[model samples]
Target: MSTPAPEDCGYPSPRPRLSVEELPAAENTQPIRSLEDLAAGTFESDQELEEFLAFTCAERRRDVA
Candidate 1:
């Protein structure tokens, strides 16, 4: 399936930019063990969402300075 544009993601603005540091702090990250956890009304906050997106988008990109 094709990935939807950021605008289609339902943000107030289209293609919003997010800072890497703006992602949720690792200490506060929650464990997503199962789909049931998501269906149970968890996964709060946009920061967590951004973190997950970043992980998916940059997973193969090495951390180069």
Candidate 2:
């Protein structure tokens, strides 16, 4: 079974869209927010990366529920 739409729809008619210049400026978009620099460090052992490759899939995925 199916139903048919009326000849007139979409709340009778739609209003004209506002131009960009006429639109109000958003507060969040005003200024660029600064982000803190991330802390980075080298591995304790140069071979650490190579050793990690030997770890099982379970070991690679930490804090599993």
Candidate 3:
């Protein structure tokens, strides 16, 4: 038994965006092992990163406060 989604959920229905056969093969799509590795990339601008950090920090504050 599953709940019905609202008619106006304001989002598309959850469906596969891509089929497994249609996906590209990944040669080196792996997780970074250390903070140093992540720090090596160049960001186009700091605004996007700053906004994400601020949003996450606010979420943590709300959870704890």
Candidate 4:
């Protein structure tokens, strides 16, 4: 018997950019453990969505830098 190719199984055949060793992790950074972290919230309008996106982007930029 023969095994199917990655494309046949719905996976990309090319090698990914990063190996497991290259993954980002440290004592300060950890996976999300709380259910509330994945909670679904909504914005009432486009302006509100833009504001939320801008705020979150700035916060993440500061965090990663």
lDDT of 1 at 32: 87
Q: How do the residues 6-31 of candidate 3 rate in per-residue lDDT, one tens digit apiece?
A: 54576667765665545543333455
Flag regions of model 1 displaced more than 4 Å: 1-42, 60-65
Cα-based TM-score, every candidate: 0.27, 0.21, 0.35, 0.36
Model 3 lDDT at residue 1: 100
Clash number for each model: 0, 0, 0, 0
Candidate no. 4 TM-score: 0.36
C-alpha displacement of 57 in model 2, angstroms? 25
Candidate 2, 1-65: lDDT as tens digits: 75544435444445557667555453223333444333244457658856766565557576474
Give per-residue lDDT, candidate 1, residue 12.
Answer: 56
Per-residue lDDT of model 4, residues 1-65, tens digit only: 99999899999898657655555543345568899877667877889999999999999999998
List ranges where model 4 is wrong by over 4 Å: 1-41
User: Model 2, poorest ten-residue lDDT window?
Assistant: 26-35
Best by lDDT: 4
Question: Which pairs clash (backbone N, Cα, C closer than 3 Å) in model 3?
Answer: none
* lDDT on C-alpha atoms for all candidate structures: 0.68, 0.52, 0.70, 0.80
Off by over 4 Å in 2: 1-7, 10-12, 25-65
Candidate 1, residue 20: Cα displacement in angstroms equals 45
Q: What is the Cα-based lDDT of residue 50 in candidate 2?
A: 60
